[model samples]
Target: MSERTYHHGDLRRAVLTAALDVIRTDGPSALSLRDLARRAGVSHAAPAHHFKDRSGLLTAIATEGYDLLAATLADAPDLRERGVHYVRFAVGHPAHFQVMFQPDLYRPDDPELLAAKARATEELRAGVADRTPAEDAGLMGIAAWSIAHGFATLLLSHNLDRPVGDRDAEEVFRALTGVTFRTQPAGSRVGDDTMQE
Candidate 1:
């Protein structure tokens, strides 16, 4: 797809997708507007016009990530299910997941960024509404998000560094989450004895 073939919205979307592809393959530090333009088959200036600078592009990506995460978590039936969805989203979109948490990489005060973040937080909170007292919702949200985020981070970094016998990483993760949330373990306790390096 050449620049001429791209309309307004299409061009922006194409550029973003190209950036995502670059991040997925080479990591975010390897991204550049010029490289994204090359990948999108657009002029180098095209991405600059839309995103202004690296921070602007990252802000857009981060906001889009939050929106996507919010949508995915919304489909879950409860807090635990939402936690699963959160990890799945992070594992699937490691590019976005990496960028979304690095506030210094983008305009954290940007209205779009703030709104998207709020929506994602609200969705996460709703999942645990009945389980948490109203006054403690914020802390519970933080704890829940932390657990999911930590698990996803470990998974992505290959830091589990352990053998899981016959179980896959996802199965072990579900078991760990079950223990954290005080739910019945999907199989047995996912301790060092059950799955260790």
Candidate 2:
């Protein structure tokens, strides 16, 4: 459809969807507003009216990602489940996840981006608040984020070893963090504090 035919916000959403598709297949460096406009069947100048520049477009993507992540985190029942949701969000939205973490790709100082980031951060920290001692909550939060983010990154990059096989990401994360470390290889044994009689 032509730019004028997009009705209010539809052009923006269409361009954003096109950008996501490009990032998914070719990475963010491949994004071109002109190409996005062409994909959306709009004027060459159409994307610019909404995003202004490449950085602005990326900022919009990151803002949407953080808002989505915050909502996903809010749905979890507890901190551990929140961690699962975080990994799920990252794996599910690899393009947005990549741009969200790489500040150089977007306008970090954008007000709307900052607000969306704050919401996601608040949801993440809220999960850690009552679960740990006040003195250690900060570290605990970082640790929890580290695990989820690291796992998601590895999984996305195909860096996770064969031992993990084709297991579901959420299940692997749960096994890695909970009382059992079932994600480990077959020969591995969980340490035993009560094995000896």
Clash count in backbone of candidate 1: 0
Best by the lDDT measure: 2
Worst 10 residues of 2 by lDDT: 188-197
- Per-residue error for 33 in candidate 1, Å, reads 0.8
Each candidate: how many clashes? 0, 0
TM values, all candidates: 0.85, 0.87
Clashing pairs in 2: none
> In candidate 2, what are the lDDT values of residues 76-130, reduced to their tens digit?
8898899899999988898899889999999999999999999999999998996
Q: Model 1, which residues run further than 4 Å from truth?
A: 1-9, 161-170, 183-190, 193-196
User: Against the unseen true structure, what C-alpha lDDT does each candidate score?
Assistant: 0.83, 0.87
Query: Which residue pairs show backbone clashes in model 1?
Result: none
